[model samples]
Target: MRLRAVRISRSPLLPLFLLISTALALWPAAPSTARPASCEPSVPYESGTDGYHTFRIPAALQVPDGPLLAFAEGRRDSAADDGDIDLVLRRSLDGGCTWQPLHVVADAGEDTVGNPAPVIDPDSGDVVLVTCRTIGGATKRQVVAGAVAGSVRRVYVQRSTDDGLSWSPQRDITASVKAADWRWYAVGPGHAVALRHGPHRGRLLVPANHSAGPTARSGAHSIVSDDGGLTWRVGYLSPGGDEPLALNESTLTELPDGRVYINSRDHDRTTEGSRADAYSADGGLSLSVPFRPQPMIEGPVVQGSVLQVRGLTGDEPLLYSGPSDPGERFRMRVRASGDGGLSWRPVWTVSEDRAGYSDLVQTGGGTVGLLYETGQRTYHDTIRFTRLPWVWRLLPELTVSQGEVSGSAR
Candidate 1:
């Protein structure tokens, strides 16, 4: 291609300047980094169509260079939290455009077995899932009030070696993950995280919550496994004595600075919205940033999910998925955090219809997949999977005082 020249006032170095500028202008521009992606929302679990009465607590996970997995609680009887609930999953091999048939991951006869917090092992390439087991009809009120026995509210583990095509049998890990003093226990209703950096890389960290005896104080903690899914142990646990922060139903995300950030749903905190956040520097074994309320991260008193994505540049941007409605469970939105989890700004709204629990996973090629509960009649009517492109910044930046979310883990 011939280079075009621009004339200027006669100067001493005019010839050289024109030659350089013309040559540089003739150079081709860098290739565009834009990645075009789109997918229509597909229902993976319809309440009345499946054998189960209702499916809730959506969890989305994708194996590295493999298929995507969507998990939920298959309530056998009704949409209630209890009564013959099972952990179910659906696999997607075509970038979540379509899904396979439903498969039951864990079923406990007439008991309730749900809270599918799944994570893919970075070392073994296996999909590990942690779940909470409870009696069929046991309510959280009764269990936290110390009326229900601890044996009912237990924890279990299961894994899939063939990319979620088949899962191993449920192995009870309550003794390794749960405490004897706790009455009520629940694993993550969202996706768990496996560490990918630092010395704790390949560690599977599962966020959980429990209410202790006597006071029935609620606290958030992590159940960690180092040898893939072989052995498990309890990690950093927060105190819930008389304080306004009654954190539960937590989510985990690993930051670029090798720290684990946790955000939980607050039931006892009346101020600073209904969400609390903390950080762990020791690979989720202990807290480093402590638990504090996020006044800017506003939402309803429901479970929210946090995910760390590296496709965006500049900083370690994170994505949060939950209902945006401050008063009710409606209008599901995905917020963006430019600086880890310290601050967040609304980016995308997955749906404005009635919605509830949601899980977020970056499938690949700068695309994020969301599996959430949404329906015309109610949020529990069905579960759908949707994929959206990472459009980077979509709104103004929002931040909060660092002093508010700064303290000890205890």
Candidate 2:
């Protein structure tokens, strides 16, 4: 077959379109740091959904990398502290927009494992977690009273090298870290801090609480690891027994000046009833000042979380999350401090509904991530993760359910 060839002048629009396409291809894309607008508060774990009766005591740590490692206690049988409870973890690589499947950190077949206190070693980049293992289902009161005969609380350490993807076997360090005379001990239900500014910089400090004997009061203390979590020792023990306030479920933060600041839950409900605090300059080996009541804040003797918002220092801009209600365990509120912790201003009410234990961690892009227990009808029904940005300071108070909840977990 014969064919004819035809030629014509290229249109000016063709060159313009080519130029635009080339420019578009060469231009660098903007990083998607902004959370999805459709994201809403979501329950990562819920009771009766995961075969566990309930979940409680949240602890989250933003690893040296960009992901968040959230730890919780999965009660296999019931919501009570005793029984087949497991220390479980869920990871979020996208600043807590979504979380990975539940990963069991340490599971004792018939015993209980809980109170996850995690700290990242800045030098070695290891996520070290310390948890208490009770041989039998025993409540803190029972343990403190020495009623659970032949059953005792012990401490174990687990390390995650790949940013919390997996954890090592639990290493028993109770003998070195706990006093043999002590009857009950629990690690932080919140994230632990590492010293960065003081002479003891790079030290890993795990905030903890313990009772001396069967009838003794509980006080706050910290476990310290200097050589990147290879070994741990009892660092500082707060003075004054448990008279003024029974310190329990404590949280820690390293000040810019190198002093370790402790925020504790006070069990004494009569006179000096408030959150307790103390400071230590010796890298937690000893509290230079004893723990005292924090009169400015009030709660129903619940575990709280304290975190230093990234890039904001000098004691100002510290963030605290807990149940703000004095008489009830409702209203999960986030308060901001302008003068270290002397005074606080409510930034947002995470949930005006039923709420319980909570944890706070600053994301890679500087937004705050909170993992807490809240439910539609009860406090222990579900555990949700919420992201709060700095802009919340200007807008009217917002709750997690009102804000966007992203389901995209990468």
Cα lDDT computed for each candidate against the true fold: 0.79, 0.75
> Which candidate tops TM-score?
1
lDDT per residue for candidate 2 within 147-248, as digits (tens), equals 764237889999988998888999998888888778788899888888887578898899988887545777888898888888989888864534656778
Q: Could you tell me which 10 consecutive residues in candidate 1 have the lowest summed lDDT?
A: 401-410
Segments in model 2 whose C-alpha atoms lie over 4 Å from true places: 1-38, 149-151, 312-316, 392-410
**Model number with the top lDDT:** 1
lDDT of 1 at 406: 15
